[model samples]
Target: MPIHNADIIRIFEEIADLLEIQQANTFRIRAYRNAARTLQSMDKDVAVLVEQHADLTQLPTIGKDLAAKIEEIVHTGQCQALTKLRQQLPASLPELLKIPGLGPKRVHALYHELDIHTPEQLLRAARDGRILALHGFGQKTVDALVRSIESHIRQKPRLKLAEAAHYAKPLAHYLQQHPGVDEVTIAGSYRRGKDTVGDIDLLVSAADSQPVMAHFTHYDEVAKVQSSGRTRASVVLKCGLQVDLRVVAKPSFGAALHYFTGSRSHNIELRRRAQQRGLKLNEYGVFRGDTQVAGATEDSVFKAVGLPWIPPELRENQGEIAAAEAGELPNLIELRHLQGDLHAHTRASDGHASLETMAAVAKQKGLRYLAITEHSQRLTVTHGLNAEQLRRQIDQINALNDTLEGITLLKGIEVDILEDGSLDLPDEVLGQLDLVIAAIHSKFHLSRQLQTERIIRAMQRPHFSILAHPTGRLLEQRDAYDVDMPRVIREARQRGCYLELNAHPERLDLLDTHCRMAKAEGVLISINSDAHHPNDFDNLTYGIGQARRGWLEKEDVLNTRSLRQVKRLLTQTL
Candidate 1:
């Protein structure tokens, strides 16, 4: 019933997808897409802003027309334009957009040429060779389409961590507000800091389960109550995220949290250890010959097993138990450990905020330094900076640094790693900046060896500092490009550059496994927000989560260093 930021984002994005399918005006489609992006990167709720009568048009890429639509969505929970667009086209057409290679033009081509609409039709056409006959759908592409569809169909649906937060966080808070609730904690993959979550596991500890169960099932966001019981309920939220709530006895709360928050493999190993010790472990508590030993707290549960309490993020059966036994568990990096962000954007590129504004917000967020790394000119769609523009910006950064008090802006550019692995900008301009974050903007389908080589070549550049979003993945939308990540990590160590753990929710690149790989190779990772909006600095939270899951420590992250320390390190790369 309440309008959430995710709701608005979904509506606007759907509108864009539908419009693009209908072959609408390019700018119109872009307007909707950009508005959706602005909403995604922002920390504040648009509904709250609307309630305060804030000027929505002042939000980046939001115009008067889009503002009116936001208000409509808030008041009525629907968009009239999206409704009409659905009427004009098959509502199922938007599903085709989910196919990896199917952009609007391709979706339109498939629809008009092969009469494909839904994913089923598209899949059928691709398998039947109908898609390959279309203008741009080559044989290889058609083959890839079939595989992508098959994989997508077989894969379970999940929400990105940030999107799931939209549902889980608010729901947990709502449960906490109930009179009888003593404690509420979200468990499962959401608690484990996984990049994507299939469902949310909510555990409530209260003396009376009836009131809490009733409150949960009757919550406003519940689209349907699958089942309800005295102390448990299963419901699907309006956003298609499944949530299961269990009311645990106050004494078993920690055990319940441990059992439910498990990575099954980790729990299995723990149960095996308990068996060896002549103790039994389960959701209720640890027991020795029918006598309860430990269960009242997570720390107590771990103590019963002769292990220290492991952070939830590290409970993935990833050698964490062995490390705990050896007392070598990393003090995982936290959001507070960061002192600077090496890769970010401003209006000089596709970013929404100005340099000064971004600086102020970064300072307010406690970052001592923020790099303004505009996209290099090779990325024309973002109005990326040319050599001359970058030079002028370097001068601007120098002048601004002189007058600024708290946060210093570092001159940098996210130069594209071209197909042949050369840096997009020339050395003369790149050498003048404090740092250069080389990246790959296109050619995501290169062979694994080629992709790895391309990145290695880019990192070998004289002025290279970091590899931004090393894998070029957009969670749920696109898979990481085929590349040898371990080889790349070693290459980074050899070349004296670093890889970026891009913190954007959509692209938490450098998978947790890769983060561990980098750490082992003695390569520091710069956990950068890659912010396009001022508020996007909040994304550092997710970055820290991903880092902790990878078993990273404060020493493994580049941005944890003070400005003078970081500058000294950056100088080595240069």
Candidate 2:
């Protein structure tokens, strides 16, 4: 099987996890972690680059040694360094890292102190109160671990939408190249733009199922062919993503797509509506008694049900049917609807690109304005800006704006919202910017009431404009902090502040439900790229998907307004 970019990244991540567990060189461990992140964000396939003999070290954060390792993995399908580490560590030790609160340090301690190498053993230790005696494992920590372990055991693994797309797009394209394949569509939660996908459901229209099944099962990325038959095949990819392929006739393509791209609740309601009309709906077509009424296209299917075609993103049975019936479905937000980005980063903080580079990319992307919201001093790890640095940056932005055309740069800071509800920077310092984005960087484990109060207090600040990544959740990594978001949304409305839908793949915060809640409270959302590099601007596409899923309209988004209008709104809070 041909090694894929995702496959290489997975190996790097595992190597990093194992290295950390073995108390290896910190820099070596960090190199692997950084390499994995760099690969994950890349749109280009590293395997193809290796085949082209391209210099991988030219990529971000990739050193010559790491680049060689990547090339080795791409060609050999495994890394000898990772294999060596695996020899010294238990194979299941890295799996413990997936459980929240179990860092490498703690896992090391557990392994040496109690010989708990697997989750089952860890669970037994926790249950026996053995874990509580460890250096850092208190009763509360043990309880949390027990709960997390049980949840982990029960839940099937899911990939983030962006991660899933990394694997899905190439496979779909490969299928399209098949000789007899006419149409190929990816259904399931992926089609609905859900933040996470459990698996990929691919429906294809082909003249004969035999050729299609052969082509799919023989793909280079397939790690295992679980099943192969005339009309359907299921395969697990090297990256551990399961893909189910089904072949449908051209006449039934739309119906099959509709059936496969479903929330069960939405499908049930549609079937109920079909029943009311004395018709039967199935994967093949809509039938009135024995005669076919509609099936050629998705629009025809909806028309047969006496409704307009609802966008897949809103097919959650969440009042979408009612809205469609009333002809009141929103023209949901799209990537093109955005006029500007309200949050971005530069080399001034932890970001990788220069301010000019970021602005140029935004201009190329047809944006009217871009906010440079670098981290404030409280986040020292990012070399965050102190008062003097922020003042200098503000002046730099002012000078740059004077020379630039077609795109304006807005001065802003992602100032930390302290535990006591205080802004990281002084009011006088914050007052100088075009806007202020307050965020909770620490104290994530606070009580819900405290977390809510902390954010509300920040919103009360006159210069506060938006709450960046409002929930502070890193998808598939850390859960969202406990906060009364409904209360926060209402407070934001009262305070004339906005909230951000961070477009960064890992932190697509201000989730769909929160976006809807913000809309209900009349608070505008700023769907921002939170661009740290030029390529990062592309992440806005995911944000737009999330906005559409939330049923947001152009009007519900703050950056959809013109620059002047945005300026006016920014000043409202002040």
* Per-residue C-alpha lDDT of model 1 across residues 182-242, encoded as one tens digit per residue: 9999999999999999999999999999999999999999999999999889999988889
Provide the TM-score for each candidate, comma-separated. Answer: 0.98, 0.96
Off by over 4 Å in 2: 22-29
Using TM-score as the measure, the top candidate is 1
What is the per-residue lDDT of model 2 for residues 1-574, given as tens digits with 9 covering 90 to 100? 6766778888898998988888899878877876777787678888899999998887877899999998898888888988998999899998898887788999999999899899899999999999988897888778888988998888799998988988899899999999899999999999999989999999999878898999999999888999998898999987889999999888788888899999889999999999999999999889998898888688899999999999999999999999999999999988899999999888788777788888998999999999999999999877789999999999999999999999999999999999999999999999999999989989877888999999998899878999999999887667788899999999988888999999888888888999899998899999998876677788899999999989899999999999999999999976
Task: Estimate the overall C-alpha local distance difference test score of candidate 2.
Answer: 0.90
Clashing pairs in 1: none
Any runs in candidate 1 off by more than 4 Å, and if so which? none
Worst 10 residues of 1 by lDDT: 94-103
Which RMSD values do the candidates have, in order? 1.3, 1.8
